[model samples]
Target: MQTPRDFTELSMISKTRWQDEELQYFQHALSQILPYINSEGLTILHEINKEIYTRAEKQDSQYT
Candidate 1:
């Protein structure tokens, strides 16, 4: 899957809908799911988010 940033670069209508729908879906899904995630998993996910952005910026960062 394209990193989330790829969706942000789309047209306003698309970005808006993405923020509105897909983001909401992910948020809701995460909400239902995060409680089941251990702290280590949470930390790993945080790192993944950081890595995704870093990769987006320089296009050279390897995702951990």
Candidate 2:
């Protein structure tokens, strides 16, 4: 699948529709490339993952 060239196109879709398998595939793909990516790419991934996990933790706490 082709990704949108514009960042705004990403906001048009809902991430809630993503399947666990698709998330796992992306995570695995990122892990494989982590070793080859430059520092800037690594920093970007780290920041994004940090936000994702932080939001997930907050959501989980709300259910408890």
All models: lDDT? 0.48, 0.55
Candidate 2 displacement at residue 34 in angstroms: 0.8
| Candidate with the greatest TM-score versus the true structure | 2
Per-residue C-alpha lDDT of model 1 across residues 1-52, encoded as one tens digit per residue: 3335342353234222343334444444445678798886566445445544
Evaluated with lDDT, which candidate comes out highest?
Answer: 2
Q: Please report, as a residue range, the 10-residue window in candidate 2 with the lowest summed lDDT.
A: 2-11
| Tens-digit per-residue lDDT, 13-47, candidate 2 | 44344433443444555678998989965764565
Residue 9 lDDT (model 2): 46
TM-score of 2: 0.52
After superposing candidate 2, which stretches have Cα over 4 Å from the reference?
Answer: 1-28
- Residue 21 of model 2, lDDT score: 45
Give all TM-scores, in the order shown: 0.39, 0.52
Clashing pairs in 1: none
